[model samples]
Target: MTSETTRKKTTEKIVVVGINHAGTSAIRTLLAQDPELEINAYDRNSNISFLGCGIALAVGGTVKNPEDLFYCDQVQLDALGAKVFMEHDVLAIDTQKKTIRVRDLKTGREFQDSYDKLVYAAGSWPLDIPGVPPEKARLKNIMLCKLYQHAQELIKKADEPEISSVAVIGAGYIGIELAEAYRQKGKNVTLIDYETRVIPRYFDTEFTRLLEDDMRRAGITLALGEKVIDFAPSPQKPDHVGQVITDKGHYPADLVITAVGFRPNTDLLSEAEKTGNGALIVDGAMKTSIPDVWAVGDSVAMYHAALDRHQQVALATNAVKSGIAAASSINGIPGVTVESMAGTNAICVFENNLASTGLSEAAARELGLPVASSYIEDADRPEFMNDYGITRIKLVYHEKTFRLLGAQIGSHGEINHTEVIYFLALAIQKKMALPEIAFTDVYFLPHFNKPFNFILTAILKAIGLDYEAAAGKSLERRPSLEGK
Candidate 1:
C-alpha cells in the first residue's frame, strides 16, 4: 500500500469534481460513514441527480412533475456536512501536485485547492454532430436530451403548436425514448440512425426488427441504415432548425433532437490512463492509473464480466456501484468489489417490455468469440390460467464452453419477465455454464410460471431438450420498444 493510503489524518479533505449520480453516491457514502471527513463538491450545473432515465417519461407526460427527476440537491448535500458549490466549473487538474483549478461560473473568480484524495466523477457530455454550420449552434429547436434543462426544453417544444414534426437522430436508447415521447404528444416523429438496427448494442435482429415494426406502425419514421449529415435550418424560421439532412433523404422536422451518445468528461486527468473513448481505466477498487485519485460515474471504464475486459458502460447503476466501490476502498472497507458488473439494463417503450444483460449475440460474434444462442417463446404462466401472457427469452453463451455470456427477454403483454435477467446476469458474473443454469431450482406457480419456466426451458432448448412434451410454442403478438 502507498504511504497515502496507510497514513492517518484528522480529516481527509476530499474534492469531488462532479455532483451527478456517481459523484453524489461517493460523497454521501464517504461522509455518511465517517462524518469527520471533509467533502467539497463542485458541479457546473445548477442541480444534481437529475435522472436522465425519466426524461422521456417527463416529456411524454408520464412523469407529471418535471422537477421530480432530481433526487439530490445542494441543500441535501450541505445538510450532510458536505459543501457543494453549484455552477462551479473545474478548470484543470494537476495530479502530480494533488491540486485543482476551479472557476466560479456565476462570477469571474478562479481559485486553486488541494486535497488529500480526489474523486474524478466529472461524468459525461452528450455527443454533438461534427462539423455543423453556425445555424446548428444558433438554432433553438435543435436539442440534446440528456440534461434536466434539456428535458424542460423538450417539454416546452413538444407543447408548441409550431413544433409539429420531430426528428430524433441516433436511434439509441435516448433517441428512441425521445422519439416515442414526442410521438406520444401527437407529433410527427422520425427516428434516424446510422446503424441498420436500433439498440444493436443490446439486442439482436429478431428483437430490433420487432421494435422497428412497432415504431413504424405507430407512425414513427424509422430512418435506419442512413447517416445523418447535418441539421438544415428552416427557411421560414431561420432561427430554428427545421430539417434533418441524411445521406438518403431530407427529413422535415420542426424540432430536432440528437441523442447520438456521450463521452466521459475526464479531460482534466491528463496523466490518468483512459480508454479509447477517454473514460478512465480503473481497477476493481476503482483506483485509477494515477495514485491517490479514483474515477467513478461515466468517467470510469469498469471491468465487464461478460466481455472480460474494461469497457465504458455508462449506466446509472454502474455509476452508483463504482461510486460506492471507490468510497469503500477509501474507507478501508474490504470485500466491496464492483468487478462483476454486467451492463444489465431494461426498457419499456411503445408496447415491448425488454431487458438485456452482458454481451449480445452479435457483439459476442463480432469479437470472434464462439457464440451460441437459445431462443424460446411461451406463455408466462400455465395455459389453464386465463391471465397468462406470451414472453420471449433468449440466452447467449460460449459455443463450446457453454459459459453464460448474455441474455435478452421481451414480451408484448403486461407480464414483465425482465426480472429473469437478474439471474442470468449473476450467472454471467459467476461464469456459470448452461448445465449449471439448466438444472437450477425455480418456482412453478399457475399465476407466475409453469413447472418448467421460460428460464429453465431456454437452457433446455439450447441443449436439445423439449420442455414441451408435444405442444409447440405459444404467444400473443405485441409491439416493441424501449432501451438503456
Candidate 2:
C-alpha cells in the first residue's frame, strides 16, 4: 500500500469544537491535506459556515437570497470524510485527558469523546450589560446582529408595518450598516452610541465627521456620547420595545438592535491562558497554553503586526487564516506560519467607501506613541476625466523613525479605491519607512490614475517632502534629457 493509504489506515482522531468560519476552515484544511486524520466537528448551531459578515448586506437588500449566506453544510462535511455533528454542543473539555463532554441538543443525550488533538474555534457572542436585568433588557422587539438567525429576525421585524422607528445601539460597523439598511427601508433610524463618534475604535474623528455628515444627509439620526441604560416596553405595544432609555435622554423605538460588540467564546477553556478580554492566548503556530490543544478564530488572541503584541481581532479574515495555520501546524507542515495581522478592514457608508489598515491617528495617540499624520485630498483620476472622483487619504507614522503606523482611505465609490490602504497594511507589516513610499514607483494611466499616485503624494506630504521638487530632480537626472 502507498504511504498515504497506510497512514489513513492508522488514522488519528482530531476533534474540532464549533463549526463557524474558523472551525470549518480548519477541518477542511486538515482533511484535504492530511488523509491520516479522522476529524469530527461539533457545533450547537444547526447551520455551518454561515457568513455572519454578510448579514448587513442581507438586511440592506444587497443580498437577495438569505440561503446563500451558508457556504457549507453537514452533508458537505460528511462528503469530505468528516464526522459532522450539527447540533452537538461541547460542554466541557478535559485537556489533560484529551476528552470532551458533548450534549446532543436534539436528543438531550450526553457523551464523552476522546481525541488525539483538539481545536477550539468557538468564535464570539454579543455582549449584554451586566447590571441591567434580563427581563427589562430582553424585549420582544429588541434584537442582535451577530448570527444568521438574528439577521432573519431583524428583516422580519422590519417588514412589519407597525415597526417604524428603529434604534440601533453602538456605532460600530454592524450598527452603522444596519442603520443605513433600515433607512433604506424607509424607516426612521436612530443610531445610539456611548462613544462620541461612529466607529471610534477604527476611525479618527476627521473621517468619522465626514461619515456622520453623510449619515445626517441620509436622514439617519445620530445620538452620540450617550450610554444606553435599558430597553423599556412601549406603552402602546406592551410586548414590543417602545423606548430606548439612555443616560442622556430617551428615544421612542419600535425595534432596537444591540450591536455593542462581542466577547470571545472561551468559557469552555477558562483555565487556559487568555487575554483580559477572555480570548485564549495562542502562538504563531496556533498552539494554546495546553499541550496537544490548539485554538483559532475569535476565541484566541492574534499577534497585532503594528502593536507587536497579541490582541483580540474578531474578523472572519483572521479566523480563516489562523484556522489554516492551526491545521498546518498540527500536521507538521513545513514552512507555514501565520503572520501578524494589521487588523485591516473596509466598509461602505452610503456612497463613500472607507478602508483602513493598522492603527489610526487616534489609536496611536491612545497608545502614547509620538506620531505624525498627514491628510491629502485629491482626485482619483485626472481632473479632465469624466469619471473622476475625489479621494482622501490619511497616513500615520512615527515622528522619529517615520515608520508607517497606520493608513486610512476614503473615496466617492471609485473602483479599486481600497488598493492603497491594502498596500499600506503590507508596508506597515514590513516596518517600511515614510521615504520608501514617498517616491515609490507606481504605473500611471490617465484613464485610471493621475501623473502622481495619490499614495505617493500622501506619503510625501506626511514628511513635508515636496513631490514637485522630487519629480523635477528625477527628470533632471534622466540620461535622455541630460543635454536638454
Candidate 3:
C-alpha cells in the first residue's frame, strides 16, 4: 500500500566480502543513500577497518595505544542496518547461483546465503618467504606487518629481553617503516632487500641516497642486493628464528619481519577474469566480467590514467574511490564515474617527506615511452625567511608533446610535499603540458614562496629558459609602468 513498503519488498540483497577499507566504504556509502537495500558483509579478520599504514607508527610508540589503529567495529555496522559477520570466511562463491558458502571460525558451522549482487574487496595478504617449510616459517619470532594483530605481536616480541636484534626483509614502504620503528626501540635493525636501493619503486637515486644515509647515520644496517636464503633457528629455542641467512652471509636476528610484498586475495575468484598478478579486472563502474558481481580495493586492477592501461595499485585512496563507484552503480546513481588512479602516494621517512604521482622516469622508460625529465632543487620558501628549507622536485613528460607523465617531490622540512604531487597528479590526469605549468597562475608571498613558483621554475628549466631573467625583466619595466 505504502511506497516505503513497496520499495522494501523490491530491495536487492547485496553481499560484500571483506570488511577492510573498500568493503566498509562501499557498505557505508550504500547504507547512507539506500535504506531499502539489504546488505551483509563478511570478514575473516576479527577486527575491521584497521589502518594498516598506522601500524608502523604504533610499533614505534608514536601511537601510544594499539586500539587507536581501528576506527570501526561490528557494533557500528550493525547500528547502520548492516548484517555484520566478523570471523566468518567465505569459503566459495557460486556466481551463477548468486550464492556464497561461508564458514564460521568460532563455531565451525557452515552455511550458504544468496544475494542479488556481490562486491569483492578482499584486499591482499603478505607473501610468505619461499622455499621455507610451513612449520619452520611459523616460528614465534618471525613476524609480518600486514594486520593490526601482527603489529601487536611484533610489539610484544620487541619487549622481550632476548629480542635485541631485528632483521626486516624487503625495502618497500612497510619494510623501511618497520625497520625504523624497531631501530627507534633500541633494537639492532638490519634491512635486507634484493633491490640495490631503498624505495626504488617510489623515489629516484638522489632521494633514496638521502634516506639510506639517514638510516645508516641512525646505526641501521643495510643488506641491499642480497637474496634471503633461509631462516636459521636459535640453538636454544628451535621455535624461534635466530639468524637470517642470505646469499652473501648470515646475520644474527633475534626476530625477523618480512615485508616483501602483498598478493591480492583472489583465490576464491579463480574462475573470474583477473590480471596476471591475480587482481580482479573491473570496468570503470567497478563491474567485473561476471554479471551482478563487482570488485574493488587492492584486489582489483584500476585503469591508470597516465599509462592508458589497467594496473593494480593497492592504496586506501584507490580502495575508497572504487568502492564508492561500485556502490553507486548498484544504487543506480547517475554521473558517478570512477576516475583513473595516477598512483598518488606519500610517505615520511625520518625527517624527510616524499610523495609521487603517475609514472616515474624509470617507469616511463620501461614502458618504452619517449620521455624527458628535469630535476630541480630549490628553497621551499624565500631565502629571506629563516624557516626556508630545500625541496627537490622531478617532473617527467612526453618528449615531443610535453604532456605531463609523472612527478616526484621530496623535502627535508615540514613543508607539504604531497600537496605538490597532488596538483601534479591532477595535471597529469588532465594531460597538461610543460608550458601550461610554466605560466600557470599561482599565489605568491615572500614568507611562503618566491615571486615565481618552484613548479614554474622547474618547467622553465626543462624548456631551456631562466625564471630569474624573466623576473629581472619584469622588475626592470615595473618603475617605467609606475611613472605612466
* Highest lDDT against the true fold, candidate: 1
- Give candidate 3 regions above 4 Å deviation: 133-135, 467-484
User: For candidate 1, lDDT tens digit of each residue in 1-484?
Assistant: 7765565455688999999999999999988888778888999999999999999999899999999888888998899899899999999989889899999999969999888899999989998776666656568688787888988899888889988999998888888888899999999999988889999999988688788888888899998999877777899988788888888999999988888899899889978898899889999889999989989999888888998988999899999988899998988899887876899998888788899999899989999989999887777788777767778888999988889999999987466779889989999999899999887877777878898888888888888786463465333232223231
Query: Per-candidate TM vs. native?
Result: 0.94, 0.93, 0.94
Cα lDDT of model 2 by residue, 344-426, tens digit: 99889777688898999998999998998987666678767766666778888999999998999886543448867778898
Ranking of predictions according to lDDT: 1, 3, 2
lDDT of 3: 0.86
| Count of residue pairs whose backbone atoms collide, per candidate | 0, 0, 0
Q: What is the lDDT of residue 307 in candidate 2?
A: 85
Tens-digit lDDT string for candidate 3 (169-286) = 9999999898889888999999999889998877777578888888898889999999987888999898889999889979899999999999999998878888889999898889
Off by over 4 Å in 1: 1-9, 134-138, 467-484
TM-score of 3: 0.94
Q: How close is candidate 1 to the true structure, as a TM-score?
A: 0.94
Q: What lDDT score is found at residue 366 in candidate 3?
A: 80
